[model samples]
Target: MHKTNFAALALLSAACLTGMSSAATPAQKGFITGTVVNEQGKPLPGVEIDVDNTLSYDSSLITYTDAKGQYRVDVRKLPFTFQVYAKMKLKYGDSTVNVELVPNNPDAVAGLAGGVRDFVFKPKPVTAEDPYGNLGRVFVERGIGEYDVDTAQVQVTLTPVGTLADGSAGKARTFKLLPSGGGPVIPNVMWGKYQVTATLNGKALQIRQRTDGRTPATWGAAYTGGFTRDYNALTPSMFLEVRVPRAGD
Candidate 1:
């Protein structure tokens, strides 16, 4: 017994000299808290909070906002390098998207050391610099490649069906799709239903809303735009497909 004890003691001493420890370093305690609100500053409850450790394979910490639109998640600040980033997970139709929340402070997530990262669903108009930063975008995906019609002579009209999401009245608008240029894009339309129609060479062409995977036979019929909700943008968009009609009444 004495000989075995001495051998173990020598081994422990050797390990100490080699700077090795038998126990893992305890994880540091850290937390992230935030609030989610809408454009009108109204609290948005049930918003999902996702906290991830970038350098480690540790499972992410997930939580949701309370009735007061507040959420808090505890994090394990591991040794060596600990980085915790956070985002808001939102559900859109059948898809979910992650939107980055702005950290209250610049290096706030260094160790997940108790920082506030708030998210606000603010819908802004689409600008040249930020085309996708708006309430919604209605795009004519195909005007030239799919058909033999001259895109320069193709005109698409959008007639608003109701009040827009921004509480503003909508107006009918028309745009000429150009083949040589970037396809026609209604970049600044707020989220709402619209009657979409197109004309090629002064002849009305059939239109379809392919955003939600409509049937192939539905392609050659007048289509009312069905926008796809984007959880990240807190808005919706429509990707319209158009085709020339065949011989019939």
Candidate 2:
């Protein structure tokens, strides 16, 4: 009878140990949460959020923020880094946040599961003024005289000087000039030195000219007679600068 009691106790103890082991196993779930805001400190609702694990290209997740601009995501495993992005209206904002996962601190590891935290974005405004404060119209004259106006199309391309990495010389910028009944003129040019080239019907007509901030009249009588009504004598060798607004004001 004593042997029988001892065997029963041993069996009960083994069952209890098996139950404890099962209870101590870690759960397979982790979560994240955060908020998104605009540059004006306003919570942005209905913004789209995308989460991607850096370690796995195929493993990605997507979600949206709630009315309070908050988001949440549940992930099975933790990645070293997760990329988060938000989109509202026509703008897109993105950032990378690190994630930590462990059994003891699962909440800490999965903090802010799939939301953009404190997002702020400001778009740069483009105006008619130049980077400088000078303001005026850009006058372009045809270097080639008296072509059939009905059959001709003019194009101009603008590029910033010293911005090209390939050491290309010529206009820092180029803009295509639309053909008007009288001629082509780019109005309200910002103030900066620019290299200008005029093209007709896909053919390069002249070399680039530098234009300063001064008006067309600054070229004196030579511009008056050559550029007035005559399109052929237009020499494309001048540089021009127009007025533009100051930066960060």
Highest TM-score model number? 1
The Cα error of candidate 1 at residue 226, in Å, is: 1.0
Model 1 Cα shift for residue 217 (angstroms): 7.2
Q: Number of clashing residue pairs in every model?
A: 0, 37
What's the lDDT for candidate 2? 0.38
lDDT per residue, candidate 2, 1-249, as tens digits?
Answer: 011122343355345434433322224345555556543456667767666666678676778778876677776456445665555443111212111101111112332333223333322121223211112234455333334322225544443333221122434334443233334444323323344444556554443222332533332111111111123322111232221112341
TM-score (all chains, Cα) for each model: 0.49, 0.30
TM-score of 2: 0.30
Query: lDDT by residue for model 1 over 1-249, one digit each (tens)?
Result: 011122343355344424422112222346566667764667777776766656657655678889987776665453223233435555434545454442332243545345556655543323334545334566675533565765556678787777755455668777654231234555545566788888887788878765343445366556775577532334566777676887783
- The weakest ten consecutive residues by lDDT in model 2 span 97-106
Off by over 4 Å in 2: 1-29, 91-116, 123-249
Per-residue lDDT, model 1, residue 222, is 64
| Residue 183 local lDDT, model 1 | 47
